[model samples]
Target: MTSKPLISVIVAVYNGSKTLQRCIDSVSDQTYPDKELIIIDGGSTDGTVDLLIANNDKITYWQSEPDNGIYNAWNKALNHAKGDWIYFLGSDDYLWKRSVFEETSSHLFKAESENIRLVYGQVARVTKNDDICCIEGDSWDYTRRGIVADGICTFTHQGMFHHRSLFETYGKFDESFRIAGDYELLIRAFKEGGAALFINGLIVAGMQTGGVTANCTKLVKETARARRNNQLRVITIPWLISYAWAICYPSLKSLIGDKNSRYLVNSGKCFVAVLSYKKNAILEHNNN
Candidate 1:
């Protein structure tokens, strides 16, 4: 790859007229010159097509057609992407800063040297009330050990940058998965010993507290399927338990205040810790 390889930023949308412009503007205003914006719209009828038409000059390539789901849209974006690195963003999300790609160029080159196919950074989450919360990249481990043991996704899609070759090697996102496809893709890459690097800076601002993953039941179920498909049965047990807990959590929060609900949740954690400690102590005594 060239020292300044072209970075392709892909945004997948569906009736996102409200937030589409902001997403386009964020990419258009990037300090990095060697970058292209590609948009894959899922046949939006909410004036989103008109907005894209208005800003056609800014986009490298764009298309509007009905797709199965977000992952399918992303796969279409991948087919059109012509950059050395590809970054996916939702129409509701935007680059966190104009210099995000500029600032991360050196790290990207370093990753290339080390044969790392994935790089991700921090993300600023914009809540429903417009409050911004910075989520750090190192907030959780994305290493193979961490993924297999925990069966959880540590990185957010908006902040992740993928070497275009990753798709060719590991295969495209499974369109069959309505949700959790990103998680499943990462699990496959990690399991295949793909190297990933983390950059400690904000890359994108994600509109949070919504989306398909917001449906807790569906999220849990899809996540379980992803884990099972990846042969992560050890983590499946805890995942199922967590799914049941999630189902009851909303009712508990509604009955109790947020503060009391949190306290109750912490109490359960404490109980688990006590049991774990006792079990370890018993095992040590028996070994002695």
Candidate 2:
């Protein structure tokens, strides 16, 4: 193997024909010279496979087979990655431009030691319908040049570059979760990982956002279990409020301030709060 491959761009795709070609094009266009793009396809029935086959010459390593879930496919790609650093760029999401590689590499190489395990610049998260979903603001205060001061935002799986050895120290992402596994990893990284770097720049990633609350119930349940399994940050104001915010507004519910609606929402909110604390405590204790 080469001495230090700078970055490993891993992508897990499933029936992604609608966006796979664009995603592949972005990787192919990256300006960085010493990087690898590992693509993992989960037996896509759509023309996704055909498209990938045509683009096979551009890919370093790729596999197409059924996997349990998205995270599982990602795990496979990680194992095959040889880059010194890792970045997970989803198939449905595209980079802001070809300069992403050049820009990201410049900042990442500044870290002389292995202690800096991660870095996240800004990202313009666009919706799948060709609409701007969130237009993030740059911090004007010189003291606040970066949006995320710490790994609190580490839970966000996109718009970041991570050290490859961080996985060896902290371990790869847990494949058991279908959602919010990123959250679980964020907590772990912040709690046990090394120093994190921030660039405070913006790259665009087109994400499908309508299902924000589509899986709230399942997310709540899985989170409840995960919290129990890895209890940390119990009684923290942010954690408590996170629990509250996760279930406070139901998309299917009536308008706010309705008497019965308020009660129901409050009740759900309370349940979330208790579960949050209990699970957080449990997980934290186990880690200790």
Candidate 3:
């Protein structure tokens, strides 16, 4: 009989003692036997190291040191990972269910034969209180055009599994990117003809809101950089509009205050939705 492939779960955290244990527990509770947990701490001073010590037996490898950012920490963790498939989990995020690895491995086994480098599922974005905001993810076929054209990341990293071959071929995450380095790597791979498989209706993890990726303006700026780094044009219409919105959002927020800024933003979104509805309605009438 053949041995099951090992999956490495890498978590990068800084001062996340409040939720770190839950993240670790999520991995430890997994039904998959062939899995390892690797954690990289960014010199957290908030007793996070103590928690790491408490759960030392459950971790395959862990380290505490100062790092530039999340990508840097992830790069560090990657050095110690020995699994066939790699998944990056956030400190504030948890596996949606204990069977995540068990279920995902089924697809991975098939993906291996097909030479697929990326396998992704859906992620639920949840509030701090555990209320789900929305589920995020889509097939590469549905998202490739947007990613290639505008550098928009439709799938959450927490829900994606990367084959070790991907790292061996394309190299690890770029350490300089404070955000969207994942996007750069994915864009590079897809644009270069790497294959990806999407597992339909598989909700892999729950990503908590208000993390580093929640900085919309900074994320947008990093996204543009990621696109340019991958040789993608920065002047695409979708990117232009997103860039404009990102640039204006902060100024508008500071000028008006959080409450009003949110109202104004929601109002703008509603107006766009209404226009889209009206246009669709007219088109339907014409066709009828």
Q: List runs of model 2 lying over 4 Å from the truth.
A: 1-5, 112-114, 136-155, 210-214, 233-245, 248-288
Using TM-score, give the best candidate's number. 3
Question: Which residue pairs overlap in candidate 1's backbone?
Answer: none
TM-score of each: 0.83, 0.74, 0.86
lDDT of 2 at 253: 44
lDDT of 2 by residue, 1-288 (tens): 234346788888888898888888888887767877889999999988898889998788899999988788878988898887888877877777887777777567665354566766665545555565453323222112111121112133566677876778768778788875655565556543346666675563444443322355555555554555575433344344444544654642435523334345434443444454466568879999
Q: What is the C-alpha lDDT of each candidate?
A: 0.74, 0.62, 0.82
What ranking of all candidate models by lDDT puts the best one first?
3, 1, 2
- In model 2, residue pairs whose N, Cα or C atoms come closer than 3 Å (at least 3 residues apart or on different chains), thus clashing, are 227-279, 230-283, 231-280, 231-283, 231-284, 232-284
Scored by lDDT, model 1 comes in at: 0.74
Error of 2 at 87 (Å): 0.6
Compared to the true structure, candidate 2 yields what TM-score?
Answer: 0.74
Off by over 4 Å in 1: 133-136, 139-146, 234-241, 248-288
Which model, 1 or 3, shows the larger lDDT?
Answer: 3
- Model 3 clash number: 0
Root-mean-square deviation of each candidate, in angstroms?
4.9, 8.1, 5.2
